[model samples]
Target: MSSRSPAPPNAAPNARAVLAANLIRLRAEKGWSQEALAFECGLHRTFVAHVERQARNISLDNLERLALALGVQTYSLLMP
Candidate 1:
């Protein structure tokens, strides 16, 4: 028997949730706050908060900027 929980209705994980989790994890690993990350990525603090909350969709360019600021590959931010 599997120990995993039942899959979500869509079966696939939400991209925004994955991105939010990754961002939170990476930021914690770096000992940075949302404002610090936003400053590093040249984005507004509210924008970073929105991203973390999955309140809005982000652009490819903004995604790339976030990845660059975090020193991670752009694709990693989208990984499930």
Candidate 2:
């Protein structure tokens, strides 16, 4: 028998969550604090924290800035 159980309503992974998880992982891999990354990206430290926590809906321009600061492609930030 299949072990998989159906997901409840609204249980699907959202883009913000995926982005948050990826951002957290990448930031940790680079040994950067949210403040440090924000400084590098020329953004407010609180903004970075909000993004990492999936509390803000980031824009495409901001995404590009983050990718450039991190030396990664913008699309890389969106991948699962």
Candidate 3:
């Protein structure tokens, strides 16, 4: 038998969760710290953390800021 554990059950889809996961993935792929991304986005580090944690309902303007900083379209963040 394989040593790897079975995949966990899939959770229900959520917009905020999708955005948060995409943010983490993109940031890691770019080797950027949350602080670095915040600087690039012209937002506070704590605010970026909150968004990553899905602790806040991110605003459209901020979404645009993040997309611009990440060099992606805003809809990319919203996509599943």
Query: 1 or 2: which has the higher lDDT?
Result: 1
Question: Candidate 3 residues 16-65, lDDT tens each?
Answer: 88999999999999999999999999999999999998788899999999
Could you give me the TM-score of model 1 versus the true structure?
0.87
TM-score of each: 0.87, 0.83, 0.84
Can you list the residue pairs that collide in candidate 1? Answer: none
Q: Name the regions of candidate 1 deviating beyond 4 angstroms.
A: 1-10
Order candidates by TM-score, high to low.
1, 3, 2
In the order shown, the candidates' Cα RMSDs to the true structure are 6.5, 7.0, 7.5
Model 3, C-alpha of 48: deviation from truth (Å):
0.6
C-alpha lDDT values of all predictions: 0.93, 0.87, 0.91
Worst 10 residues of 2 by lDDT: 1-10
lDDT per residue, candidate 2, 1-80, as tens digits? 43545557878666777788888888899999999899999999999999987778899999999989888999989887
Compare the candidates by TM-score and give the number of the best one: 1
Model 3 has an lDDT value of 0.91
